[model samples]
Target: MHLNYAHATRFNPPCPPSQYAGIGLGPRMKSAERFAGHRQDLARKVHEAGIKNPQVLQAIATVPRHSFVDAGLHARAYEDSALPIGHQQTISKPSVVARMIELLHKNKQPLGKVLEIGTGCGYQAAVLSLLAQEVYSIERVRALHDLARTKLRPFRIANLRLIYGDGIRGLPQAAPFDGIILAAAGLGVPDPLLDQLAIGGRLIAPVSKSETEQQLLLIERVSSHRYQRTALDEVFFVPLQS
Candidate 1:
């Protein structure tokens, strides 16, 4: 049950497990050694990689990484590499996921609501589910949604609304998020994301290109239709799929 809701919402409450147990993660299965090992690895890697947010670290640790991927790849579950989660999408590397979360909350304020632009593999969405008060996640692929919804069955996250659409457009009706995170890279920063960020809120993503890898950009919504952009670091990711 604890592992089951890792993808649904970011709520810190405990939830019951779903009986389906797709990919062998259910009541009948126990991956204690694997889970514990991944927990320790995440602790070391996240800290080594400079993830300063304790809450984010705990959320990453608590959410079972293995359950979101192909069960056959269980052995590589904790590796600091991205694995395919179908629809040609891969879960962002654990470090990348944690870093983005840390970047989103760098200003040290309470986030009222969050908009997650890409829900690939649902790993990033799961992490956001635990940290933000509310999450509006958009997934370009449909099959991923079905998988994520089922995996999130056991979590107490009630504030997340998953939508299947273009990651570039974002969720308009639920705009004005306190924080925004884009999981896929795209050429230039998407205007819709900036438009949706609430004042004093931050948006993090890679300002993308075709030939060059994108740089991690942190934009703060200073006023309506205005933002302050700061370059965080260089990052590589799948191009944002519309």
Candidate 2:
């Protein structure tokens, strides 16, 4: 069944001091404290908008978004807005991330191996690692790929792998993923990505419906050759490059 919904936009203020009491603080504790505080605030806002998946919400709270962006913008890390991550790409808004993942989770099965197109700064991949058993992320820009590798390494997210390549091509070696997500908007869903999804898998992305509008889309592979499409909230994302 095809479904479409208007985008619900909401933003909340930073978390209060009481919220950061128990988060550990050894070397990066100060930054960790800020992330904890802001992530809670972001999760609360995402939940208020109807994202009820506890795992998704917890992942949102646990991932340190500030680490994905430039240090100068760390102060705005938890503000529910996208931050530029160089190469003219931007980290996706926290709400959009939560919404897409929530929709994918509606598949009602464990997300085994997930494929992520556009691994900008590795923020989404980090979150996906928490939800799925393994995550394969592809980014086209070598600079961004290298940067994301460095940023994500310290986290020791062993289940996540970053690849520098053409994201539209998807990963054939890692085909049949249980879930696929794209960070950049494309004219339409790429066939390679569809072919890589397992029968019960779900792929979420932003597709350009017209020159002026792009809509969030969910594609679920029901059978070998049968798939269902659902159009969701209006969204803005960097265009996918070849």
Q: What does the lDDT read for residue 12 in candidate 2?
A: 19
lDDT of 1 at 27: 48
Candidate 2 lDDT for residue 67: 81
lDDT (tens digit, per residue) of candidate 2 on 1-242? 10111111221121222322211322354657745777888899878877889888888988888888888998888888888988799998898999999888874534688888988888888787777766788888989888887777665555566777888998877688889999988899889999999998899999988778999999999999999998889999989778
Instruction: Tell me the RMSD of model 1 versus the true structure.
Output: 5.6
**How far out, in Å, is residue 233 in model 2?**
1.0
Where model 1 places Cα greater than 4 Å from the true spot, the runs are: 1-34, 107-110
Evaluate model 2: give its lDDT.
Answer: 0.78
lDDT of 1 at 49: 85
Which sections of candidate 2 miss by over 4 Å? 1-31, 107-110
Best by TM-score: 2
Alpha-carbon local distance difference test for all models: 0.71, 0.78
Give candidate 1's error at residue 46 in angstroms. 1.3
Candidate 2 weakest ten by summed lDDT: 1-10
